[model samples]
Target: ASPADMAHIAAANPAAVQGLLADLEAMAQELLAYRADSSLDTAGATIRAQAARIAELERDAARYRAMRDGLVSGDLENNPIGEAMYELGERVCRERGHDAIPTAAEFDAAIDTAMKQPTCTCPSGDGSLSWPCPQHPPEVT
Candidate 1:
């Protein structure tokens, strides 16, 4: 109530004003007791724990996204060997026709076989063949 209303009530009945003040004081005490209780502290701890977990999950999601992008993009910074292998596989697929595109296991087996082949030395004494020999074109550099 406004001061004027309180004054009017006090003037009309001082006892009633005293009762109103007592009620207000009791309410204030109740509020103070509630604040002093441990429930608020427990609630705050729970909120903080949940917030920390959410932040950790967000960080994990970001890391996974970065890993997924790295794999899908085949960028040199993240997967240089994967990028090179993909390019070599793509070239092979194009040269042999799309219908003959190798499965993952087949491609791995083909790579293993190629790696096991003996290096071919050119018969010419010029020694012009590259490091891998005449089977592969001469290295440009």
Candidate 2:
């Protein structure tokens, strides 16, 4: 019950009211002590970390949602340029006509695999590829 209801009951029963008021006072003291002992700084740090992780998870969720929607709707198939490119790549690949067409998953996996590999074959070989080298980019070697 609310404080107002309790107050009314206490007014009608003095002994019972006194006991209830005493209990409330004891509870308030305990709450204050707990508040004083709690570490606000530690709580703030934990809250910040949790918020950052939630934001990162939200971004990953959006990425997966886009991938799922793309697969279900075949938005790539509807684009004329994309369709032409797909047909061109299919023609270039030396596969049998009866072979299965590569899905978006296969294309994504291939691109990811390629991105993880070294780009240049020329081994001046500092374990680093030359960017805009004299033989490469004509403007800024």
Candidate 3:
């Protein structure tokens, strides 16, 4: 409604627009800096997470090695027992004319029979008893 007001606004409009543009430029620069900083932070977090994962994998590998060694040792210690079981299975197969690989029931029965049979303490070595009974250790050959 006022001519004087309109004239003043027209005179200041260019300078005001320039100031706004300068402010926008500054804000853009800040945004770029913030992006660079945030990317570095993200990279650090990723590296730390990966390192922890690698450590966990190493620990798991160690445990697996230990378990494998224990199983091998147990198998070694029990080999004689397994051999005895196989021997009994073989004798039954040969005498009865059955398959060499005995069934589970036959295997169990052979094991039970072997356990129940008398184990002679003599050094004859024919029985399943330990050689050189505690009472009479054989003279060292």
Using lDDT as the measure, the top candidate is 3
Worst 10 residues of 1 by lDDT: 109-118
Cα shift from native, residue 101, model 3 (Å): 37
Q: Flag the better candidate by TM-score, 2 or 3.
A: 3
How does model 1 fare in lDDT?
0.64
Which stretches in model 3 have alpha-carbon errors above 4 Å?
1-13, 73-141
Q: What TM-score would each prediction reach against the true structure?
A: 0.32, 0.31, 0.41
Q: What is the C-alpha lDDT of each candidate?
A: 0.64, 0.60, 0.67
Least accurate 10 contiguous residues by lDDT in model 2? 110-119
- The candidate with the higher lDDT, 2 or 3, is 3
Using TM-score, rank the candidates from best to worst: 3, 1, 2
> Which regions of candidate 1 deviate over 4 angstroms?
1-36, 80-141
Candidate 1 residues 1-141, lDDT tens each? 999998887767968878888999999999888887768888999999999999977755654554465578856565533544566678778889766665665545443443333444656423552355554456721
Per-residue CA lDDT of model 3 for 23-101, tens digit only, reads: 9999999999999999999999999999999997775565445445545677755543355566877787898777657
Top-TM-score candidate index: 3
